[model samples]
Target: MMMKKKSKLFVNCEEAVKICDKSQYNEAGLWDKIRLKLHLILCGGCKKYSSSNSKLTSLCSKAKLNALTHQQKEAMKKVIESESAK
Candidate 1:
């Protein structure tokens, strides 16, 4: 019996997802991008996920969303604590 070695370009779904996320953030290296693209070619689910991720990122960027400041979070927490105590 002969064992075949795994190709360096082969990536499982999990790793593909991680790579997809990194690619979205422009954090994936060239090899990782190539692996992700190859995996996406064969994986319908991951392809859909990548599409949705891209759409979501685009929507978030266009939405101009803002986060609460630390003071606002502390105020909200105090309010919640007081309400809980009531």
Candidate 2:
């Protein structure tokens, strides 16, 4: 029982990153989040990765990214008008 407890308590940097990503998606279990939190306290690389991931997530979330080109939009509009006229 003691060894089991010890073995499950800490995760390595790799596990922490995977867990952190899973956590961002709400896919990680409670125990996984706890273990990830513990690992982040000790592992600087994982912590940095987690922070960067969070920033990327939030930036993507709030960013109004417009990918359509003006030419594409005009072409699409012309297609729609032609279709509607028929």
The prediction achieving the highest TM-score against the true structure is: 1
Top candidate (lDDT): 1
Q: Which lDDT tens digits does candidate 2 get at residues 1-86?
A: 36545468888787788899999888999999999989988888888999999998899889966789999999999999999999
How many clashes in each structure?
0, 0
Cα lDDT of all candidates, in order? Answer: 0.95, 0.89
Give residue 28's lDDT in candidate 1 (0 to 100): 96
Tens-digit lDDT track of model 1 for 1-86: 99988779799999999999998899999999999999999999999999999999999999999999999999999999999999
Candidate 2 Cα outliers beyond 4 Å, as residue runs = 1-6, 64-86
Off by over 4 Å in 1: 1-4, 84-86
What is the TM-score (0 to 1) of candidate 1? Answer: 0.83
